[model samples]
Target: MRVYPEQLARQLNPLTPCYLIFGDDPWLVETSKAQICAAAKQQGFEEKVQLTQETGFNWHELQQEWQAMSLFASRRIIELTLPQAKPGTEGSQTLQSLLQQPNPDMLLIIQGPKLASEQTNSKWFKSLDSQGVYVPCITPEGPQFQRWLDARIKHFGLRLQADARAMLFALYEGNLLAADQAMQLLQLLSPEQPIGADELGHYFEDQSRFSVFQLTDALLGNKQDKAQHMLAQLHGEGTAMPILLWSLFKELTLLLQLKSAQAQGTGLNSLWSKHRIWDKRKPLYQAALERLTLPQIEHMLATASKLELMLKQQGVEDWTALSHLCLLFDPKAHKHLAHIELY
Candidate 1:
């Protein structure tokens, strides 16, 4: 019942009784936890009870939570985070007992730091792994790191030209989170052409100034004032209009994809994993998916396409229309756009 981090999603179907996610990498550990939680929610594990193995920890709470019924949901998840990576005598006894008496209504998830050789061979750890899943979140290094980076770049549908690939590899060798973000920005900025290392540096410098990402973040969070401010700043700073438009179009395309997936009755967790959504940012996107209508996104996306064509013309600088396009993402601004057209 051992699973690799990348293979975790395929194995998530038919929920497991227990999942043990242990790792040293923060991003990997957090992302694995999010994926599991997303999968658990789809399987009706709506309510969650969190426990930490810290000072004066109550080992008996696990048993109590297992036997307890939820007022909010019929089924619930019990997440035990072990900072020490080891359960002491009482904790061991409690875990063995809980495993002996498994309850279908409760899903047990345990996470902690990376395990040593002796720790993995322990009786309790073996029992848990045999019964459920053991996901070890070790950060990738060297070639393994390269493979991970390549997968992320491919996921974003990007082509790296000249020394761009080598430069990127050297830039984010050990940091998976930064690599993903870099690729995301690149994907948004240039979806159709091969990008060079020089362009990479230039785009990231502008990103530091108030990234296209920040604007998208503002739009996703429905922060009208912040999005408008960032958009105007980007314009004043000479951000290419096509790049801004492409980023918005990319976000709208994702929204449409998520909406279509929902209509087809897909699980949120699977969609998130397939789309490579990280854990911390799920709430922003989840809110957008729940709130925005398909028709609204389609209409705005159409306008963006037209705007793209218009921006290609010589001597045409329409910052106002782009400002209006940013507002189209706001559900509150729908009324403002209802009586007008932008082309």
Candidate 2:
């Protein structure tokens, strides 16, 4: 009597009198509930009665609604919502009793926030688990997030470059509602071109005001003044810190590649050809390699990776780490080098 989000489309049974949908993620919970409601409606559920557990709510009223019948419709969809997911003695007993005697005329749908482990083991929950359908909504994190975003992009019939996808994930990592809203905006704005950082910036100007590629290029060139100016401009333009950190990380990665190739005694032409580095941009990589030692590149990469972990940690909001990274390239800024490891 349990269903998954992926299986809901094919496995929904309108004949099942009760359904329990509960989760901490509001977007997933609501989306699953909508799908179930649609399935019920398709099977001739013509009437809907909604009930929410609020302050001073009467459980007896739910019992009354359960026993009541509509003259106009033979089948009804009854929705019971518990924001707190705590149905006291009377409500719990009532829910169990409703499940005990299955009603073919009435389809009962219950929704709520996450329940504690003990609450899930309660008599009422057990009854629903046995007779009704229980659906749990879990939020995606890390690699799971990328998979979810890829699926969503495919659903929208959209294409995105690697950098653009990183920007999108950075902007809406933990918030599904915000991600869906941004996707809707992208659908309206760029229906043809493959999405990159510029397109993401163009549409979501408020979040991605500056191009990530430009930031990366500036950092790689080590034009101290130009890099600082662009960094400040990007921050002022309301760019997300994650995108900035990502740009720095990418630049350091490319520099490390170049340094490694040079250390291996690879010819410049062969190195460029092997890595597919464009001709016009070869000087940028060569200049960066000359400016930064292999140890320096490794240290910068280490700091960038640490900053990424810091940003992902819950409830930690110090963006000075991003500023610290930009200062690493500043020739005039040596006071902070004590923290920079040589190797």
Candidate 3:
């Protein structure tokens, strides 16, 4: 069963037999896993919470465990976590086989990041689709994210003005985890009071890391210096490079898509509502669409891919490559220098 992230809360049932929870967002992945575990326990499968890491574990061990009859209970929930399931790895092979013949008594929950290209079409993926549910905990976008935020505020019986919601949306850039934390902080800082954008700005005044909002502002304003500085700081602070890349890539990709949609005669308002684009992101998207052509966006994505490859192959010194890429967007710099020599 294929399911969207928004429908997850309603679709997830305690009696579901299996779940394949995978995505780029760690927060989404964790939340889905937690929900599944809680639901399973509620269904009297608490003792069957089997956790297994993919690394170093024998593939046969999982099969054996799954095949074994549940002595303690009539049903069980098996959670298999693959933290490092790179392509062509033994873990992937094991998962392939396990997906082929899932145990009836066990509700297997496979949790991990984006599936590798090869794994997406593998026998395991297909098997999971046919036999169980495949719920992608992808990052929320546009209106979905705003709705999520509003629900979060309402959950605590707090009220936020529309402008305040827009401010939070801009500040977090659809990063649910950060948005959730910020909301919690605001609740603590101003309980029972309606929050305005000014309150948010004042609260975040001294905070470092500028957040994704600042990154977008700098990029759109052609302030390459600030953009590079922010990137360096995020990298230096040991933030996962892939996660940052994903965020940036997602923004660019969405802009490119919106640009195409606009060209096809779709109204901005309709597109925004359809894609769930938040109000705060409308200006940023418009700016990006005007500034970067489709070819440029595609090239940037390619450059990002190459950068990721370099980082994985050559390690930390790849920051130089990133810095060079940043120079491509510098308004004062010669555009000719944008050409990157691939290794």
Candidate 4:
């Protein structure tokens, strides 16, 4: 029973005894939970109990509290927050056991950070999904962010000039929380005010964020545009050039190992196992292997060495060199790199 946030207004499973909401975006996760809670309140589930998983959390307390609610014949919603989204062995057993004792009077809501692919298959997670509604709230990316921004603007009861909207997209592209806060400020300052491009600078600061892992993953997965944009964002955020170079160099070294091994009649699985590559990340490596040859990978590694040497000797951070190095991952962009002066 998986339900998306957008479909909650009409297709919300109000009759379910449990709801599991999880995501990296707090706004989306909180919004979905509030909607479910409101629906539960309408169905006489007026009593609410909130529990946050902290250090030395007692799993037994949950069972005891539910029993207390059942004993009083009172409908209740137990809102449990697992910050790390991890339930150890005992906690896992406790949740599974609770599923066996279905209480019509109790509505359980478990909210947490996004679960990894492997975490979703746990016994407790399976049990909860089998009997409850699972809503995964994910942050929008690329053009999806544009739609989300438009919807959010409408929801805030404000209109934006075309250039003003684009400016917000540029300023808060990767950071949703900051974007939401910016919207709140705008709504508070002048409800229903039509924001102009010039007003955007007065009201908001640049809050875009990108991680090195995101850029590397995008490059390996052949998402050239996203990787390019993330690189620019990282540079703008003042990420150390040495750190960025090291990450790219690491990926290049790994790819070189794979390409060299595969060329010498070695199986990819053996190399992957030796490298400790996670199953989910194997596809990204495979994409890189298919796109690049042994010589090309080796050339990129040599290029990285030159950039590292140049940075240490001259103390000049050459972002163009880094961009050219990244762009080489894309066969189409490889030719374009010749035009850029690399150090």
Candidate 5:
């Protein structure tokens, strides 16, 4: 009943009736949730009903939705997002009842923040364990992060020099989302180019010509005007929009994580060590963390994701989408623009 995040992809074919994915790492949690949803869709679970544990949320609605038939969709996926992982007495009874009579027409997905040891051993959890799959999404740290980075780079069909690997590890050690984004940017900026410390440093830290890395740092520092200029420079250089969007969204994701950690009382020094942030870059992260709240950072990320989808799926103009995303970080742009639309 217990499965690792990586293993869930292969396990999706003979889809289980229920899935319980819990973890603290937002990146990992989101990745696993997306993969499961994708697999469900591939298996013809087209209709999705999402339920979140918010104040005034009626738990009975879940049962009603489960029992209802969709006129269009043959099968459906019911997603319950328990942000706090505390399914109350009513929720627990509902879960127990659902498991007692598993639905064949709907796939139930329970997602939440990490669970405590005691909570995991509860009767409700045991019911999930016996009947479905439980996946724990933990962020890798230390050497584990190193391996994750290496694998991620290779997965992107790219190779990195040894020193470049170390440099990337130092820059994006604890943050998988950023590391992955960095790789994607690299692929776009220099397709088929070897990844080395110099290659990474050229864009990330050095005085290279206007580059994606520089734009990322500018966004992190919340230098709106500077970001706009660099974005213009990159666009002028014929840089691809997907790569630019990837870099911006990646930085926003890291900022959101750091902001969340700081809000949760994690010290700057501890974060630095945990994330292997270097001396020069610490101030940028610190400033961004202080300037942006978790909600604002999340909103930026959501907006960037929307732009990416628009460019890829809806065939929107690449420069238009990238320009709109750049505006999200620019104060001046905000004053001029009426409002940003998100999909």
Candidate 6:
């Protein structure tokens, strides 16, 4: 009843009784839900598709709906979405009971964010694991991501120059949905041509403030002015500070890992294939590895973690402090750590 994210597309059989699609990636979760619904409709559960959100709702109603047999329709699909379900609550009890009563004609689909610690191994989850299929729409990680991209490109009947593919992977950082969108965009921009690194840069040139690639480039190039400007713009746009920090932290961590792997005599091609590095991203990763010291990278991660905690704390509108942390990475402020520690 458990399925890998990669196999979801091909292994989805119409004969399953229920589906529990849950994960950290919002795009993957929603996409899978949509596909399941479409498949349900194809099986003639169109009019009987019932969707429910689990916040502030009467739990009994869902149980009742599930228990009630269809009068006209031969099949039904109930999609229950629990955005936030506290442990040991009435909702949890209801969910546990519902999982016990599996229906052949009723396709019950439940989804939520990364499951709670207790809920993951709960009897309810276990029941679903045994009876219903659970598709984890988790994001790809490290080198497995490149394989995913290669499959996607092949599916699209497109080819990316080695350098271009590497750059795309570096920029997207294993965010499959973003990479997919970028690939589609590249196809649109140059339909008949295989995209090269230069083309990739040109297409993403104006994305200085929003693009992770541009942000990384700015940091690596020690362009303090542009980095600060982009940080300010992102802040003003109300982009979650944690998201930015997380992305920066992830990229640095990857660079550190890749650097270590390379130091151990890993071949560039082998490393790229193993780490899922595309050809275009090699230059950026190489640049970052050369420019950042282990201590510096460690400090950046620690700063990012602290910033995340500060943002979560009450009444901490410390944008200036956050800005300072980001600006410290700027070449102009490379030696300015004395004042940063005070903040």
Candidate-wise lDDT, in order: 0.82, 0.76, 0.68, 0.84, 0.78, 0.69
Error of 3 at 5 (Å): 2.6
Over 157-228, each residue of candidate 5 has an lDDT whose tens digit, in order, gives 777789988888766644566677788888888778787887788866421135687788877777776667
lDDT of 4 by residue, 1-343 (tens): 7887877667454568788898987778888888988888788788888998899999889989777745456589899998988988988998899979978888889999888877789999999989988888887776888988888898898788999998899788767888988998999987877889898898776687778987899999888777888898899888999999889988999898888889899999899889989997999999999988777787778888889989999887888778888888986765666345455
User: Pairs clashing in candidate 5?
Assistant: none
Worst 10 residues of 1 by lDDT: 202-211
Encode model 1's per-residue lDDT on 8-52: one tens digit a residue: 998788878899999887778888889999988888888989999
Compared with the true structure, the alpha-carbon lDDT of candidate 6 equals 0.69
Best by lDDT: 4
Cα lDDT for residue 321, candidate 5: 55
Q: Cα deviation of 179 in candidate 6 (Å)?
A: 2.5
Q: Can you give the TM-score per candidate against the true fold?
A: 0.58, 0.60, 0.60, 0.75, 0.59, 0.62
Count residue pairs with overlapping backbones in model 2.
0
lDDT comparing candidate 1 with the true structure: 0.82
Write candidate 2's Cα lDDT for 72-105 as tens digits: 8668888999888889888889888886666677
Q: Which stretches of candidate 2 lie over 4 Å from their true place?
A: 13-15, 205-343
lDDT of 1 at 285: 87
The number of clashing residue pairs in model 3 is 3
Candidate 5: stretches off by over 4 Å: 205-343
Error of 5 at 304 (Å): 43
TM-score of 1: 0.58
Tell me the tens digit of each residue's lDDT in model 3 across 1-343: 7776656766566445568888887678887777777877666675554555744667767777777777776777777776643424555566666656645567778777777667667766775667667777766655676777777888767678888877776566446777767778877988888888887788763213445545655675566866786776667667676666666667667767887887788878888888787787678667667666666766766777888887777774466666665555443343665564756
Residue 94, model 2, lDDT = 88
Identify the superior model by lDDT, candidate 2 or candidate 5: 5
Q: Which candidate is the best by TM-score?
A: 4
Clashing residue pairs found in predicted model 3: 142-276, 142-277, 143-276
